[model samples]
Target: MLVVRVVPVGRARLVGAAVRRRLVPALTGSAPTASILTTPARCNSQLAADAHRRRHKNVITGPDAVALRLHRGHLVVQHPRWPVDDAFFSLAWLRDHCRCRHCYDNSTFQRKTDVRQLSSVGNPLHFNVNSTGTVLEIIWHDGHQSEYSMRWLWENSYVGARHREQRQSRLWQRCLWDGRRTSAEDLTSVVYDSFMTTEEGVRRLMKGFLTHGAAVVTGVAPTPAATQAVVERVGVVQHTMFGGVWEFTADGRHADTAYGRDELLPHTDGTYYSEPPGVQVFHCLAHHGHGGETTLVDGFAALNSLHQADPAAYELLSRVPCAGEYRDPSRRLHMVGDGPVIAHRAGAEPTPDSLLRLRFNPYDRAAARRGEPAEVEAFYGAYGRLTELLWDARRRLRLKLRPGTVILIDNWRVLHGRASFTGRRHMCGAYMARSDVLSRARSVGLLI
Candidate 1:
């Protein structure tokens, strides 16, 4: 006959001992199993005593011993009587204070409470295992207590899976800023004579280009010649039917044309081209107009709103790639890209991939139609939603372009258009390929 002894430890020790005692008789299958030699009453009494010992040995006095070590940021705990690994301590604390409202109802919104404000406190209020050790609770400075279960804490604490999905649904893009003030006396000479003529200016310009996806250069003359000066310095000027020279006329007939429309909503220009120029340069030749305010909205903001409103719709748009086309008797071009009206890269901090062109000109859509029903529906749905957000006046920043100001935008990052013009307004605009800027800047050692 063989006898086995099992020692209980932590919460599972008692259960393990009970299982061992019950298995011995079942395995032997003798007349009364191994306990036949002893009286039934004595055997029953012995079993009860063993159960009591096991329960008492496993009893935890104050908050689970494992939880205490974690709050202290201790790497290891070895009291011999109660030994616990770092994972046991670390994971226990996380399980308790999951930013989710189920554990901490600090706000109606389930966003994690800001920890930045707590930096001033040496050791701010934190949730921990209660003194009784049976349940976990938050120990507030005011002496309030909120108990939470281990299972609930664990479930909400590790939200990496959900976070990954969020990142995938955002769009990422850049904006540009030149930081050159208009007040300088020799703004052009300051720009031309300085390193801007050398390598440093090129680098600074490229840095702004990469940062904001657009930039402005002051002191440059807002003339066709000045436009050429910029084109010569950076990249090839992007040309369009309304390129090189642009007019801001109140003539109703001129307004009917694409270039003449006043009070224009936010829209990416040149959606009609198969490959819209990657960047746009507008030199303000004139701006005496009263209401022709140039409004700019961070397309990134619009994309985020769409994502939060309808994640499923957003996902569909991102996955389905579509073609945008524009055509006239003389020229026809199409743009091919993947993403929803607002698409984002997949990561922890999601950003917009592109500020999808959203103004729905039926005439343009009709020309671009390749005859796919599902794709068409998806495009219209995303386009409509994006247009609604862009036109929301509150989100925009209205700025009037004064004469001699040059605004360069990453065609992909910005959607430039005009408000109604009450008075006189004239502006010259040009498009420049992004590649041209990169190549020229590199030649000048501005870009590495």
Candidate 2:
């Protein structure tokens, strides 16, 4: 007799659905006859004993093995490790997802055949849970075989409780850090050469950047390419019309004052773009100066304090959109956008969402907003309060970036500025997308 089987590879599993088939001549007393009738799933005691020999790497004994059971037409898994149990998948899903060599193409990781055409009569003839209880082997009415791993089952397990867990994870708010408390030691900095050359260094730097929305790497080449190299360690450097990794000097010709020798305020760049830049990088190439320090303010940290002090003010700023404009006469370029001074989830009530980006550029900010008289007044009041909190001396961290120093900022979350300089201070920098930064983190298993 010819039998076909599909099974999961390694440690992934599934369980779920309907079936059909034909009865053999010996059973039908005639030539092969089709039978569309559905039948109950039967457990196989012999195959179950044989499957016991193949142990799963992550299995536990005793009560843990009791975590799995057949309920009606479904395979129910009760794992104490995670809060939720997977009791949703049917036998059909388990059968259809078989990853056996005949059923799946291992090289391309693609399914060889469709499962939807399986007859309703295709119920399991027998099933076995291995010693680790992580794998389940099954035999179907048509003599089809399958092996499923518990890890795959749990990863795909989705139910009402799963959504609740998702919401809980999303509500995480970063702890506020100010100058006095969060110093170079707290935020931590990686050596530039090591970060570019080693996996451990890249992971360490990524950890700090992901955790704080900013990080520092020292001992670079003090050049534009050096800044690009730091960013490229994780992902490619994103280019804009401003060009890739351009140098910033007092004498360089550019539309923005960032090219000139002026002290900038704590603000996020690229608010003028519809889709603002995600991550911004800066490298100090030469520093023969007195005051070219970089300033960073934790915008979310500021919002937390503001939320505690004044709910009305916080709500107003989070609701009202402010204006940002960048105009270059030489290039005949004009860019503008209006968004919340403090970006967050948009709703009538104030519930802090994960992303709390700040866009406070006094120089780039347009004139006072025009709106409903009362709403506009409340917005201005909230704006003033937030500015006061952001500019507070204690809240800002000032770092004198020397040559060979690179600072990376999350343009969406952290606000940055420059301390005025007198002598020649040249800086080179680049910008990268937020997605690439995060993709590299996942690629290295730093994030899942």
Candidate 3:
């Protein structure tokens, strides 16, 4: 990749300073000599320069230079020394992305001027690569000065196979885990206080939760705010219908079974919403109950097993759409969402990577049927097979949570339930949006 540094307009006098030692004069018939930019930090040391090139797999090197020329109203961008991925940017695009302080906001990193504001762009006045081979200087058709890194352009080039391969390597790939794969390993745990206090500890917490689908945070206070605090450390607090954070206390109600004492089936929460919560957290405030042990299963892993056992069944479930709804007559709230038992990106061909996302919630399903009689029959057959594979002895995990113990789950990947309960059990928890988790992960290089 090319490294770039922009010199201020006033610093133009120093342009020849770098060319004296590093660059030889190059001209295409009376054009001013191409000036070279010098960046000591990136170009001074031989070891650092080698390391930079190695990071990019030697796509661009210190000796590489951007060769600019105007030919038939199209700007030709070439690098004779490297030329790993030559490209041409239209004058329209370059004018739009001018990074000058006046045209773009450095603090917010937002473009203040729109490309539409320019009435016309004819041709560039001049262009050249600076001495150190890091920055590309351009004086555009509209007299707007700009600088860019040759490496950045090469890395982002859409025409090059190297750029595509490099990007795919960094994409977040999911690993399906089941009772057999996860086994006796805890998936590793991090203390809540340490995770809240240090960056390294927080990264470890993220690694455990994101990589394994769920993680236990020990020694968290058995309070509602503590659960909120733990989730807020990684992202913004996600508010939902249940409020910012809520507490469930087995209220012994007859209507709302969630607040009563019974077995909660292995299912995802809030399938009724268009965008379900990405993550769910529960901090055990009090768990004096004997049979309310939490049952956890990896839904994706179960699907993989079902596919291996019966591909026809998996295909049926993937094709039949199921309705998920929430109705509260007294509160006057009813929301519904419809999708297949195994959700996949619409219009995308089926594959292992395309199976990255799915949803299953037998309990929350509304009283609605899709497809014809034969298709409905086929769907249930596949659904039953999937359910059987999920509930098998080797597929489920049963754990009894204690007070001060916290559980964080990737709601999209894992299904959680509670066994039958006898005594009082109070749990305080909250939700987190998917965008927050993804943005935070990408920020710290966890996802890519």
Candidate 4:
């Protein structure tokens, strides 16, 4: 094996043609791992390939390691400065991902190269790392040349250190909290004017919201228009059958229990939708009677507890698809959706690190054939266990929603409910798309 060390881009020395040819390994019968070429069943194809590269034991390292090389039909790279995997990228993948102006249009976010047309042009006539070691130049047999910056490659490489950091950062941003770790007083809050007018206020709110899955803006003018304004400030209003920025009082204005004067258990909204809203806003305009307090529960915290207490139950919830629906014959509306209560991250399986979102709304669930007798029993048992944790007093934060205060909860991560009230309670709020929520989080530098 040819050994070489990586230096700072500015300090890297050019090694002419001799070094380049030597980096291309000889025909030693060694081949890329099978795991790298074939995706496993029920796995994200890209992630599965990445996982293999990340776990490869023959990682190029050491003081004399060849940081960049061509082996068998793959480009292997290892940056000494970071403790990441030895990335083995196939020539085909590299050609398809070329971001040159000819292959990609930067201005329009459009791709000029069609992946389907790259099969005949995957062969690289020659490949070279520039003297600065910051750019990789590849000349294809088809007379096309592509250049990729080392930084860009690292960012896009699934096995790179940056990729690991990004995934871990998202997981770390979520700090699970319960009644013990947080309280009504400890729930994050910001001044309404500051939140509406300043970036600093938005940053504080977003940080808190990302960390705890909930936040409050105090002093919001307790009106439907004012509440709508606050919702729009964070993201575009997600319109549903309920309309944008809806107002509801203690009357049968809607078919759901929310329109009545009854206590609602901790649950997420829009379980019936294929893609549920990311955030739910609530601003109480008036409450004439008593016993109408908003309840907040961190679904993740409950999930963590369940995972530790009963792995089997947690696994069941992560695998079984629960059917949810919203029906109203009078209004001619009947929406239906289904998914695992504990949704895994995209392309991931039922692992702790894969837990991405939660969908828990017992009231809105539609009847379904839950499989075999044993499976049905297990599903219900797990469902009941999770519900118990969600209802635990020690895991809940109850607070009275008052005028001039707007509360926003991550419907994907937090469960919310209301206490039974006596007289009358009027409120206005709207739903926000999950993408917009993450977009704001990314804009404020809370997420990458």
Strongest candidate by lDDT: 4
Lowest lDDT sum, 10 consecutive residues, model 4, at: 33-42
Query: Residue by residue across 152-259, what tens digits does model 3's lDDT show?
Result: 545544434455555545653456776655642566578887878887777776777776678787888888888788888888778866678888888843234677
Model 2 over residues 26-69: C-alpha lDDT tens digits?
21234332332222222333223322332222232332222333
Local distance difference test, each candidate: 0.47, 0.67, 0.66, 0.76
Whole-model lDDT, candidate 2?
Answer: 0.67
User: Which model scores highest in TM-score?
Assistant: 4
lDDT-better candidate, 1 vs 3: 3
Superposed model 2: Cα runs more than 4 Å off: 1-77, 85-149, 156-175, 345-353, 366-373
Q: Count the backbone clashes (under 3 Å) in each candidate.
A: 27, 22, 6, 1
The lDDT of model 3 is 0.66
Instruction: List TM-score per model, in order.
Output: 0.48, 0.69, 0.73, 0.82
- For candidate 4, the per-residue lDDT at 89 reads 74
Task: Mark the regions of model 3 whose C-alpha exceeds 4 Å error after superposition.
Answer: 1-98, 101-103, 112-127, 139-145, 154-173, 252-256, 306-320, 343-349, 369-375
Q: Tens-digit lDDT track for model 1 on 198-296?
A: 666655666566555556666777677876776566766666655554544555423134445446766665544554566777776776646776766
Candidate 4, 1-448: lDDT as tens digits:
2234332223223322111212111113232211111111111233235434544233332342334445555777654444554677777878888889999999998888887876655435556665444577877657788888766776676556466666648644677888777788776799989999998898888888888888999998888889988888889999999999999997898899999988998999999999889999999999899998999999998898899999999998988889899999999999998888998877877766567889999999999756556699889899999999999878888899999999989999999999899987889999999899889877877764
